[model samples]
Target: MERYFKRKTQPEILEPSPKSPKNNESSSKQTCVDSMEINSETLQYDPGLCTPILSYHPNVRDQVRRAYLQNKPCQPKTHAFPYTNFGTKPRRFNPAWFTQFPNWLEYSTSQDAAYCLCCYLFKPDIGDQSGGDTFVGVGFKNWKCKKKLEIHVGRPNSSHNSAWRNCEALLNQKQHIETVISKQTDQDRIDYRTRLGASVGVSRILLQQGLPFRGHDESENSLNQGNFLEILRWLRHSNEGIKAVTLENAPENLKLTSPDIQNDISSSISYEIISAITSDINDSLFSILVDESRDKSSKEQMAIVLRFVDKGHVIERFVGIEHVVDTKASSLKLAIDDFFSRHGLSISKLHGQGYDGVSNMQALVAVAKKNSEIGDLFTMVSSVVNIVVASSKRRDILREKHTHVVLEALENNELSSGQGFGDHKRFIAGIAKEGSRYCECNELGQYMQRMRESGWESLFDEVSSFCDKNRIKIPSMDDSFTSGERPNRKAHPITNVHRYRVDLFTDVIDKQLTELNDRFTEKNTKLLLCVACLSPINSFFAFDKEKLMRLAQFYPSDFSEHDLELLKEQLENYIWDMTSNSEFVDLKGISDLAQKMVGTKKDHTYPLVYLLLTLALILPVATASVERVFSAMNIVKNTLRNRMGDLWMNDCLVAYIEKDIFNSIEDEAIMQWFQNMKTRRGQLF
Candidate 1:
């Protein structure tokens, strides 16, 4: 064992001074190594001060490699290299050598030698092809051997060439393994967002138009793969980027075009719209207008609308539809309760309840039916209309006769023409302008009363002239009248003048007056008159503080005694401000005034007054919104799509009825909402 140890010790001892000149070179190399320090930060750019690449700690090696590559080779082209003695001549580093090996050539000031930048950073540990570290470790001091630089580079497979390639790869981060993986992940996320966005955009359009999303056959070979898919294909074809990543181009699992996916996107969009509306409501008092109708599926669907003040403007939004087992009051109440609970609404916030106009019209029709003469007149008129409409020949003959009469009247100058025609059109347009219903009712009643009292002779004259022109015989007013019955001898007789004037003309007018009076009762008319007092027309000329206060008294729950007192004072200030301010001038209607008040921030100034305005606005003028919702239901849940689920149909109706709200919402918002609903196959972020 001692001899084995002695053999290893003897080689180490003999290695020190075997070659005297080589020993001296080794001492200088050792001294050079001792003078250098390797650090990642404050890296030594000078090649002479940099430690050998192989001597660096493994972890620090990469850091040094990157630092050296970034600083590049220290060529020192302008530096004056000191002269050194060769065999028989003086030699020194040449600046022109840098041009020959521009990338790898590096000059060190301390050692007065050249180095290889690429080899120093990445040269392998052991290989004959690696070109012994003359340029890397000891540095190249033999200026006479200028061709050694080319020799160090060697062949394509040489270590130095490999090191150079590695340096290039390090500089280009895109080629790094981590970067490649990250880019793939980022691209997938972007494609997912784009695909989802396209799907949402198509859904929004279909929902707005109340168009069906799916077709009967949706196979790949089918010509029509539903509205959702066909519209998506069209959109993809229109856009290059979208075309590259959606539908057929998308991944099998992440296409986002499945039926389930379309429903999810639609539900999300509906949720966002409801969220926006509720956010606008912000727990403010609101009235509910509900109406029930049977869908094509025969399901009793109840549509609910929210009428409230949003930003001081009266807004009526169709919040949702509910399916009830029956249309009974209890069933409807339960359905409404469930819907409100789900949507975070409180029943206490409901200020009023309104149903569709169908009930009122039915009541009026029933009243008319009770009157024998009125009932018979309506039946005969309806019969005539049906007869005229049911037969094509009769309709054609009627159209031709009417056209002939109109043409004859025009030629005879009995009808208005030219400027007179324009005046008549203006008169009709004026009647169409929006006005208080109560005011219109009163005006109509007064107009009818005037026509009844004094306009009969003019009507009689016109009738006589029309009969004469048409070559029909006219009965004399003084002649006896007889019923055209089977037994004419037994019929009661009356004068023609009394029969036509009293029985026909006066009877019809009196029935119309009674119906009008019954429809607009004294109490209801007074309430409407009070409501109209708040109208912002004629610079609020209709504004009456006492009348508005009286209107407030009608809703005692909304306004307390203290509120009424405050409202009285506020109303005085409100009317003065409205009449004087130019912003309130020329306001088209109550809605316009509400918007203007909110725009001018006056709603914040007079809280009580604004509250009154909201209350007035919330009163359902007509069940137009509810009627429109049921109309949309007929279109969305038609015979073809009658099998749609209740929840799905409601979502479609909400989107279809509130198109303005749907349009205002962004696709990105809807996409984010869908993403957060649950863990999806593809990330939308």
Candidate 2:
């Protein structure tokens, strides 16, 4: 590389120089001769006078000290000073200038010029009236005009003195700008973290409550700042640490309470809740309850719930809802399967399924009564109830007579009053017409036995007593049984009321019993019997190994012969173990047994037994909870929010129904989870 020197500009004269005076006196007045022409390349400026170096250097102190120590007196040989041409005259540097000052003067041997040592070493780059490259860049070597060098040093507080102070400060190195800014940056990061933490704390509360995040007006003048912003403001006002670094103190773009951030917090909270439930379920058997209905948009939606044993209690949790394209059974099944898979649930672990029936059976029963013979029987039973309990007078008389009968029966030891049978007026008004009460074969059989043992004579006497007391008619043995005409277009035979009693009442009761038995067939009977083996009450005697083995035979698709054998052995051992253990002895129901077993860590001991218990326990007659979810749906997805998305609806439902779990979550923990999801401007926790 070639090195080049910055060319210095020379002062220009307005006119040509005057011709040298011819007089000897004029020539004697000038201390130097006129200039002569010389090549510019041969002239060299002092290297030390080029510029004062201010860039960072570890050895700057040594370099400055060396320059000061090397300052020698410049009594250079007069002839050795190079002569350079400025214009027409030639000016030669006179180096015989050491007589004026001895301590601060510096002479460059190469340039044959003199410089001010103090100004060259310590002059600062800033400020006006600097050396202007004279004492520094181009040396001041005009020996005939020596006063210029004295003026270049200037006053004590001049730019030269300031540069001297800077040089002294630079020697310490610790006062550098980079080090100062680095410390400030760390403190800035800490303050930013504190500000972000306050914002995250507010987000958790709003999400857990299912409250809206944004307000209509969030400006400084607004009184209400919405849930997210308002809560943060409240936190700032109440907490000293948060107040110092939040709200206006925080950066605008990094408020950390945007809708996206709120959603992330809510989603993380939901994940934690599901994780807890998942752990509770573990690999245990569970049941499903599903109810499919249409939303406001007429789209089919299936609300699903899980019924399982958690700890010692049977808990039912709302899992989620699924949107189905169609209402067909296959479509619903596919939706359920997909929903389970997404949540890491297995249908193979399902022990039972509960469904909400499509329509109210009472309306269906009314419609069917017009065409079926069983309907005729039901109509007769309804008519009997109407006749007995129609008027206030007849109702009072029936109650009085019922009370008398009950007192007499009790006194004679013919009947014993129980909890539900204590009040005659509280009797089921339409007992014969209710299918549930009538199908209870044991109760029906007991009723039939009482009627037979008491005979029709007592019934007749009682009716005669009521009729005679009320001044009503007493039909004889040959009276017509009906006041209306029969189907055959002839006047029917007038069989006596006694014969009517034997015919109409007997046929109705017998037909009802027969129909009920037919409906409750061997399939249902065996199923109920098998389910009985899982009962934990009555000394757990219902847990018969033989009955359970027979029940396992029905589900060939699920249980093979080997499985059945294993189940039978498990059942025998379970019965013996439960009957012997003090913990199992007092268990009152299957749920109680399940809970006790889990508490004692005995569930794993008899996996098949507990599975059977789960199956039996979930065969509840009603899916009222599933129906209740639909009822809640009508309120949640009202006219205003009818168009809400499926995921949003599910989230709302979860938050609403499982509020206890949501409330149990700690505020700090929720904020921590939200912050972990992504990096944000603010620090939360």
Candidate 3:
């Protein structure tokens, strides 16, 4: 009996050589391939179809045995058992035998015979008892031999009884050594999870609020042991079960309140958020917006944002912030390449790119400086601002004088009092004027052209009125203008009017008009016109079927000829549907229209039109998402936290800027990921 229970010596499994033939006779010699192929899903349940138990690889033999045991024995009691002629007498299997030996009796309909379930799975190779092979391999169909069944269940220590005992022990998992040991380890894992969850919760709160995690002194005796530790302590006190297993009560090595642990938790959370964003993108067409800025430590940091349409709604996600050695184009390209590779993204899918508009303005200003008069005017205005703000006393005096002027204006009713009454009101009024004037790109270009042709007189008059009110002398229009730098007598003379109106004012306006023409070329102007046709304001008043069809032609790669034909029809129906639907009546912009289309499921109804809308939304309008990341970087890596590493700063910034994504993640997920990052002193799962 003891020998039957001894462990068997099995051959080592080896990998099959690649050079081996698929139909080679030696293929049977490879055990690893066979064992890898066997699993619960592939296990045979029909008793007659099962292979010999010892023929299987020893490594997976137990798995196969458990599968068979879990499924129990296959008993086809309803089967019509056939009989063989024995001494001129015909007989068949009796269903009453199943009741007599309920645990081990199994009938295979394929062979029309009876078999033992335990002996098939646990029968030994060395010791052979009478009729053992008959029950295991050859079917026992002797209907005349009623006493053989009792002989098979012979003495208590017989081969059949021993195999039955082994089957029982295998089925009762509570008696296994590993299960008994895991009882204690399971408690340890529960406690570890509780402790780690508390730590992650604290980290999330600090990350969301953009607060620093560490203090000047983190010693236990100190009053402030940093936000991470102090917040964790407060959480511990709030819950009794957590208090009993966290902080001072936890194992010193597994407290998970160290700065490194906090960083790991924060990084895991950021990666999870980025993973979700990429998943939402799902390898579809997307646009990237990039911007770079210097942190408080003077390190050049580049931020990236991904813009894509998801489920008929436009989404912009802040993906990462990388520390580059320089802000040159080449360095930025390399940084972007690395970011794309790490996030499983491809530049081929990028349909658009966005950068700071300040670069274009800076180039325009540089070009405008070519005129000496215009250059001198800009220098004067810049110098004034610099001089006033450079001195604290001067800034205070300027503020006081501005306050007195505003008060006098208010007393005289020159300024109105109400909500948004001062600078905000003026800003809104200016925007209203511009909005009314420049309804489209072509209009803006024409407006600039008109400004160049006739705007100088009004500008000059306003300047003269300001000078007279301040009691400053206005130079005569006929007086000869001279350079301020020690008058060059060799140069040609010019009147004050030409200097102020032509050299300075006219040149400035002409440069602006040239920039406008350069930016809004004929092709770009046409594209903008097509895009404006989809505006949802006032019940999509700008809707134009022909213009939208032209827009579809621009993206030939996305819309085929067949798609275009379908889109034309979709557009005709779409306009009618949107104009009649109250859900889209008061939409403010394209973005609102997009969301409403999704809410009403119109995107699915008019998929081709929705595709055009999605493509329109993918166009990069601004790099504001990237700019927000830089703003978050300043707060996360301020002077006090200047020493924070690049990776740490990036992690904190991602969590802070995309708090919406960060908040959606569960603490258990973050804790599980952190645990798997490295081998810990305690198990988490």
Candidate 4:
């Protein structure tokens, strides 16, 4: 105890002096006095300043504990017993008995009583049981009942034994409460992640298939648990790893399959798919196709599609569906611009446009003058149809004449009796729409080739000989004919039937030749000719080096002096290799050439060439694919799902329309994506 004392200043002691009272004359009075004095080192009751064995602070209490453990309990000297007038004997504390239980038997000189040190420091609040009050509070001063100290420490499960166990644990220090709690938190985080993973896995499947995620009744007794929960339960049932760690096993509030959780997972999957599309587009030139329609609630939504070439394959992805207040062209253009800005796309990439109910070339009579051959043929056809079917009387005469001609031919065995022709008036009326029946550009191309091969003289001879054999009169060029009658004057007429013949025939041939010339503008034709030189078809006989160099001049913005020089060298090498290489022989078109370039690693070597090819391929000639998107929308967002949100609708359309790419995505990859999105309570994959 002395070795543990390290106070800076020595403690001072004081003794009260005794004095006789002035009125007192009794010197023979017997005074009750204490014979044994108490020491200051052992009597203070304040836990912070006194013997630190009782301190709650480990630093101070542990030091005192070690000092006390080094020595036995102290027992001071005592004097003769002070007798009380009560019938009981005053039992003074005995010092010799301290040797029997040296570690617990302690004497407090100030109290003139003995106490158990072990029980004083570690005694639990068991009230008066097991002599708790006797050993610690009003110290046990019963010297005659020395066996009471031994009785207090009774059997193996006694309070004293429990106190001793606490004392032992306090000194060990390894099993702290904080350390156990920290380990528990770590395990909780792991379990939360596992639970979240399982929830995300179930959500991705539902989103991918465009399936409904909820049910009308999702109670525990219901057999159908909805897509989200039922699938989660099935995952738990199939996998032993998460069976005991998810769903019902998880905390109520953290089941991880809540509606909010499902939506969050859906957003994550949609984000990943959008990210993939963005990566594929990656600054490439793209075209936009926009179409508008009224939803179930009559909200006008503009569905936008991106058409671009990705690795030589033409791909169109649904980027977003925006709600527009009106369907004006300017309003639509603004909406398109805003959508493009939101998705990090540039408006300059747009190359073509289409509308559902728009007619740009509506006046075919006006457009016919652009090509004289088409104009002449149109004028003749219009005149003939008007003259033959202008009135009911003329129509009846033409019908009767045709019937007589057919009967005569049938009687001579020159025509089949079962031959029939439908009414011509209805056919002319049905060709009302612009570019409806007569605008076949491929057919025009074929007709131009025939005229060039057979010459105009041969065509005229065939028509003239047919009319002569049918005994139809040919109008003489010198005959006169009335053109029209004026309101107040006689109509003027002209006679040159041969002049009309020469003019009509020559006009048809000249216009056919002009169409071939007017097919593409100078710059466009040069570009097309250059592009054609890269085509792998026509037996690869179209690859010309001169035209390709001319094509480079059109894009002065992209091609520089150095680029042109490099392109020339590369083109020569490319054409030489393509003509001789057996692998190139199988490619039949520019599309196949572009695809082969990617597969054969030529795209990396000839990047610019591949880029040009991709641009040409992606340049939209029609909006047919965009129209298909609207058609898909009609099916997906029908009356039943009319109230679906814009974001949800876009997600469903992306999954439904681009199913080919969606199907290629792995389920495990989607599951992992959901797991990494946020912290949860269970594992998925």
Each model's lDDT: 0.74, 0.58, 0.74, 0.59
The better candidate by lDDT, 2 or 4, is: 4
For residues 1-685, could you state the per-residue lDDT of candidate 2 as single tens digits? 2357554222221111233111233223222211222111111123332223322132333343332322222233322345667666677655445565554565554455666555555654453364565665456667556667656656877765665565444333235453344443556667766665665556556544555567777888999877788888777778887777677776677555666655665555665565466567876667888878888777788888888766646677776677788778898886775455335464556777766633333333444454445577888999989997778898899899989977887898766676344554345433412221112344444576567546577878888988985699887867655546445656555567645565554554555555546645777667776666666677886667777777667667457778888887887787788888887776656667777888888889987777666665555333356776776666656665677667656655565566677677665565555544433444322
The candidate that wins on TM-score is 3
Clash totals for all models, in order? 0, 10, 0, 10
> Once superposed on the true structure, which residue ranges of model 4 sit more than 4 Å away at CA?
1-184, 217-226, 233-249, 294-296, 346-530, 544-547, 604-607, 660-685
Number of the top-ranking candidate, with lDDT as the measure: 1
Worst 10 residues of 1 by lDDT: 31-40
Query: What lDDT tens digits, residue by residue, belong to model 3 across residues 602-655?
Result: 888998888777877887664356767877888888888889887787788888
Give one digit per residue, the lDDT tens place, for model 1 in 45-163. 55655545544444445555765664456665645478899978999988898888888888776577787888778877664465576766667898888777778888998888998
Taking the tens digit of each residue's C-alpha lDDT, what string does model 4 give over 173-287? 3344533444446566667667766776676576656677776678999999787778888888888767777877988866877765666566555555665776688767676
Clashing pairs in 3: none
Question: Cα-based RMSD of the predictions, in order?
Answer: 30.3, 35.3, 18.0, 34.2
TM-score per candidate: 0.63, 0.50, 0.68, 0.47
Q: How many backbone clashes does candidate 4 have?
A: 10
The CA lDDT at 416 in model 2 is 69
